[model samples]
Target: MTSYDPQKIIDIHAHLHSDLPSDPALRVKALESLLVEQGLVDPAAIDAWIDLYAEEIGPKRGAHVVARAWTDPAFKAKLLADGTAAIREFDYQGHATGHLIAVENTDTVHNVVVCTLCSCYPFSLLGMSPGWYKAAEYRARVVREPRAVLKEFGVALGEEVEIRVWDSTSELRYLVVPQRPEGTDGLDAAALAALVTRNSMIGTDLLKARA
Candidate 1:
């Protein structure tokens, strides 16, 4: 069996042309064909990965976890204390989430996650990793100039707010618990969940109170 290599996936994408088909489905199919044609990855490996993200899990799981933490102080305490165990409350304990750690965005601190070596993402929780997340530029730049990168993503933090970048590995992954948006005091968990964006959970985008 040919083992899947997340780093190789990045390398393969780096070699793909910028002018790939615009249609999302066709774009994925084109990439798959190119990788298979180049003998860089096996078709089954690609399909298995696609099925894992497309059918089994997504960012909604992470959003609900964040929403729960926002509402339940006890669960928030447990989550900050032991993320892997706390997420099991929602049956979000498997594979990429086995050794999860939750970091909070507070008044003085903000957290962002990156896999400097490869795209070692908690996809089972965060869904398919974004293309930029898997890019070499992001992996290298986010660690060195995090504040600048955050700004580029439209997340401008004051100098007083410390930005911490967490590196993910196969054995461990991170989840950013973004601060609850103001004016959401009456929102239920589901309503709050609907407000959570994947980028907000990734710390690239800040959550704003709905108007």
Candidate 2:
């Protein structure tokens, strides 16, 4: 217990949604497989559950949570202070670790998330990342000098905004929930969600609700 390194664990997934098990068969099957995989169920239910999920629900189901943060500042603070709850505000909640801090990509700092060795992301908010973000070139250079890497990504910020690079260590994971652009005050939730792209949440792009 004394030498426990909590930052050693991280989950970088494409998406995480509760809508995965919509049908009765799919729900039962998914539940069964999850139970067994976690050592919570017996072997008898594994095969049948798999078959049922495949036939009933089809593919894996997951939801995105970044959109909600884009519309609400108080919610955004909640997200920075409590990531799991902030994600839950939209639906696809994630694992609650030691702590989570959300840095807004304003006209000052552009935030990006990466695991130098592996992929680490906030699946609940941004969905899956593109192959480019997970590439070796991105992982290494992005951390050492973020501004340079972002320039390669077609992001050339002026002196107004600072480019900040954060390393998502093993114990704690970070999510870059970009700030809503200056003039997007009137956009509704649904309209705002469309702008909260995976990259925007990762701070690779600006979150623009209006042109």
Off by over 4 Å in 1: 1-52
Worst 10 residues of 1 by lDDT: 13-22
RMSD per candidate (Å) reads 6.1, 10.7
* Candidate 1 residue 87 C-alpha distance from true site, Å: 1.1
User: Model 1, 151-208: lDDT tens per residue?
Assistant: 9999999999999999885678899999999999999999999889998888899998
Give the residue spans of candidate 2 off by over 4 A. 1-64, 95-99
Which clashing pairs does model 1 show? none
Query: Which residue pairs in candidate 2 collide?
Result: 6-171, 7-170, 7-171, 8-171, 14-127, 14-128, 17-62, 17-63, 108-161, 108-162
The best candidate by lDDT is 1
Cα lDDT tens digits for candidate 2, 113-187: 777878876543344557887899989888887888788767778877767777886756677766666676776
